[model samples]
Target chain A: MTASVLSRPRPAVATPTAAKPRRRLGPGRAIPFGAAIGPVGLLTLWAVGSAAGWLDPRTLSAPWTVVTTAGDLIANGRLQDNLAVSAQRAGLGLAFGTVIGTVLALASGLSRWGEAILDGPIQIKRAIPAVALIPLLILWLGIGEEMKVLTITLGVLVPVYIHTHNGLRTIDSRYVELGESLRLPPGTFLRRIVLPGALPGFLLGMRFAVVGAWLSLVVVEQINSTSGIGYMMDLARQYGQTDVIIVGLVLYGLLGLISDGAVRLVQRKALSWRRTLAD
Target chain B: MATHAGGLTATRTVRVRSLSRGFGDRTVLNGLDLEIGEGEFVALLGRSGSGKSTLLRALAGLDRDVAGSGQIEVPQNSSVVFQDARLLPWQRILDNVTLGLRGPEAPQRGRAALAEVGLAGRERAWPNELSGGEQQRVALARALVSEPELLLADEPFGALDALTRLRMHHLLRELCTRHRPAVLLVTHDVDEAVTLADRVLLIDEGRIRVDLTIDLPAPRSHRQPQFLAYRESLLQSLGVYQTEG
Candidate 1:
């Protein structure tokens, strides 16, 4: 898709910032059971290795062992508690970041002065990785849930702000003219033109933001922590519990997959008008 | 049909005097003057850089900030159609038609307008789902839906294939008769202007060079002796003297 975009020069009207045009690209082919093939194969290999005693349990836990360990942790309620804590942190961070990012994007995207003031700082923030600020955040806010959530929010905000802002900037001038000719009031103009035009970019940013949230959560939970799957894995590492640590890894992977899927589903439904290469 | 004379004093739906617009040291429209009486269909013929669109934009008030000074007066409820349909892709067909319109009656009016344009029962279709002609039809539906006193179309059918353009021309004439809006259609096609317009204005050097009124009978055709004459004159006006073949 990027290659096609790079090779073809769009008309002067579609500037560089226009929500990446994927015009008339037919819905791509889907393979039967394609998504499941890799993971299923990996699980099968792990089970086979464990059953055949070829894999050392300390170094690598079997798929079944990890599952049972997860079950054991759940039965003891420690897993549920830690899972709840992790969920709250990530959810709060995502929600807070989304609101802040969107509002900031609107302010900056709509006005010249706002852009001059906010864009430079935001771009600077984009350059500084969220995880890199952990030490400073820890020193300022202490190693609490606030610091963790703040870090995740910072991680998620940049993509949302950047993409949404870009979307705002690149709305087709034709539509602006149409709105003006029709004499649409300011509210209708923003609701009909500005919001919908920015949606594709906003949704694209969200896909990145969700992943960023998980990325920040993974690192954030490890900071002098008492809870979360990350903390569980840390504790397991001290005791050399391979199965428990594997369970933690799997949980993080599953969370990342599920949240990303949810965001994608919303993106598809919201911007159904868009004909992109994605399913 | 009683062809409107230059003296038709019922109402001038549009009038512009000494309109001037420039683009970075290059003037596009130079002291242009124009007028269209109520319900009159005027076709503007000009070469690519002849400032036809700039004038239309000025009339539509889309270039209020972009264009230079002009004493312009047009109906407040005028609508415009561009070369592309310019339908909001995200909105459904019905929504696009009723876009800026309000009140409970707007939807009913939108539906009626769509039906008039032969697109009934397509209210739920997406703009992208439709063929190029169909999208332009929706654009027409939207333009006339408001019952504007004036309609400014900037090559609305320019993107269509020849057959579709013909169909649209028929639709446009029929709709204009029913709605009775003063129409200013900008086009490069001489035949299109001679066929559909009550009057054809040839624009050159940012001003109207020739304003010729059509006194032809109904069901205008290419084979008509007057039609051929009008087309020849318009082609010559645009600087193409004759066909090589």
Candidate 2:
């Protein structure tokens, strides 16, 4: 075992022989693409049941009716306006939460005094539900965009804070030693070592923060709002516009899928180094 | 290049004196003193827990816990390569080699070092993509690129397969010949020590037990009678070798 293993030098890495031309798989791509057929089939079954009078079309509107009502809402400009308002609220809230949470997490993760002063309060804040604070936020900030943004920010902050802190704390000690051995200045060390090392976890936390922002936006908008998708859904329910409600629901789901997909694309580009482990 | 940049002639000797270190309830080294000349390769060979690593760390100024009076003055700062590669997982291959350099010409120097280690084309590869031997080479490149006056290596090639280990030993010798850093290598392998070092110092029970200087030429044969005799002497001094009747 020893002699044979020791005798062989490392094999040379195979060089690429040629650049293969790209081939288009337009029709051939349809098989793996059709893997989504199961969810589409379920939606069709629901729509058929509702249309054939076996189900209440009033509550569970047929797919075609939902689509038509969505088109009407879009034509009237109400859907776009509501969507813009909700998106603004979620975007602002996520920005606020991410900035504040990341700063606090870095301070706590690196300094003993910061952790001592902040950990107790952070633990208490994490234990309480963000939705339960709606009444208090409304009392303080009034029933307006401030209240909605505050609620969403509160929801997003805790997860980002936890994940960022954990990420910073978990950087390998060897890296710190390496920096020390090099005699790098403090600012250079933090910039080159600490920030880059903690990035993957910090970005992961931001993704969770984005999702939390949407969830909190729904609850906040439902509670009180003049505009936004959740408020539109509430308005539709009062008038018993079941199709309009379904339209609003479908739009919300689509917005969520798009937001999550955007985060995933960013993750792929930033963390291509992580692909080997994923495989 | 061996001359100081300020036009002052570089000091040629490394002076380490009265070094001591210990953890709570366990003393590792006591009052160790040694002076190494410039361009010297000294191998510290010993059993595990025999204070070889501790002494190396103390000499490198990595152990702040030791309560002892030791003055080590070299022309420039020291660099260490541990048993593990300790390469940053995020950085590309060339970046790992350039890790500690703090000047404008770092990338060019890094490429030169990588080329010296026979890893010229792998600069853009990720750390995980490289084999174990390649990773060790990167670690060596990182240590060597600084052109440190003193290099402290603690079993740096311990994880390599024997053939790779032999190649790495040869590479170290070649680099030392050109750059001429005073290197102190700690290893458990006796043949490795006998081949690589101009001098071998065996540390045991927190003290230097054996100090011998070899006048053999570079690329000396392991099969030579003198080489075998020195190997036997070292093995016997470590109390691990039994002769045939």
Candidate 3:
């Protein structure tokens, strides 16, 4: 061999080319206060527009006026009272919807008989928008708390049922074999395999459920209501108190954002095992 | 139990008689009969759709889908190691090994089994944290944790790399020597059969085409004449799990 050939560096790494393993991206960390960037930018735009006389308070209230109005409402306790009522309504509806969705998902997901009995009707319910039922609900319940709460519950449950049922159906068949080979008891199998297998789907559904709750809440509370953030906004509409309407909108936005964040935090903790560590 | 020429009786741990399984119009296991003596190691070799996995599944009592009729006598205390580790990804390693095991000593037994597979301190790690070979080791630990009377493996090392498969063969031999469970390893590798099994059964057309006994020692060299002789003989059953047209 020539001296040049002998002196040539061997291939940089002598690793086998067969069976390429996926490169891990390593641990991921979100930037501090990254989520505030968009809202802050929007606030700055609104503040600048109102300060420069580009925005009319009649058309869209200035951001500072809305903030001041919020502070005034808090000082006089109107914000607190309406917020409490809104929170209570949302909380009750969320609990009822989540529980019903979970129970129905279990009933349909686990057995053929259960699926036959429950899946079709639930799927049909899923096809129809919850808001479309409001007129019928108003006729029956007379636009009371009953109608509003039920609307929220209906909106929240469909996504939960859909995602949970999908998760149950898609559990790996290999795990089922493993369960059988291990001879796991019914209780252990349900707790260890079935529940965990469906958890990701349940969490995914909750993400949609929270949004659904808020969307339905907005609709129901605006319809001749005496309480809630939506009611306050509607009341402001009558006298052109645009600042109070803006305040109500801000509260709704914050509530929706915070509730979603809360569910995401739970998801992170519950699914921490799914994150692959540095290899 | 059957007596040998030397007057030693062999206690059969498994006995399958006239088993026939079919899917639609095609039969996979047709009148298959087999027996495994106590503590004996057997390897089964076959092509794709040649009834190898069918036989293993039947013995594992996971043959609910296949239509079959036969008497299968398998011990209640049995464990299986599949090609994939099939470890629950959400569970820690120790919990995976100890799954379905009962009593107070279960955790301790799980630890010892993990230690036996040379994964002493990895009990808390997730299954995905380990390499493919290590995950297979965990599967082995899970299988042997219960001190089963019979161990059925369906290409347990088939998914590993060449080097990993070699290491696993040694680990399996060492574990088998210590635990002495009647093991039935199903694989497509002819060389693997000669290196591990006391007997290799070749199944074709849903029946035993050949039954070759390996008279070699533990950790048998693939290069040895006897080993190659065994491989050369069995290599006639070609196809890497290929299906018939």
lDDT of 3 by residue, A1-279 (tens): 799999998898887967996777965676799878988899899999999999999989888888889999999999999999988888888989999998899889999999999999998998988778999999999988999899999888899999998989899989998999999999889888998999989999999899788888889999869999899999999999999998988788888888899999998888877873421
Provide the lDDT at B221 for model 2.
75
Per-residue alpha-carbon lDDT of model 1 for A1-279, expressed as tens digits? 999989997687755766776776865677899989999999889899998999999989888888889999999998999999999999999999988999999999999999999999999999998778999999999998899999999988999999999999999988988898888998899999999999998998898888788878889887689999899999999999999999988888988899889988998789888776554
Stretches of model 2 off by over 4 angstroms after superposition: A1-38, A275-277, B1-13, B65-76, B242-245
| Interface RMSD per candidate (angstroms) | 0.8, 1.5, 0.7
Query: lDDT per residue, candidate 1, B119-236, as tens digits?
Result: 9999998899999999999999999999899999999999999999999999999999988999999998888999999999988887899999998998999889999999988888
Whole-model lDDT, candidate 3? 0.90
Taking all chains together, each candidate's TM-score versus the true structure is 0.90, 0.88, 0.89
DockQ value for model 3: 0.60
Where model 1 places Cα greater than 4 Å from the true spot, the runs are A1-30, A51-54, B1-10, B64-67, B242-245
- DockQ for each model: 0.62, 0.31, 0.60
Docking tier of model 1: it is: medium
Chain A TM-scores, per candidate, are 0.86, 0.84, 0.85
TM-score of chain A as modeled in candidate 3: 0.85
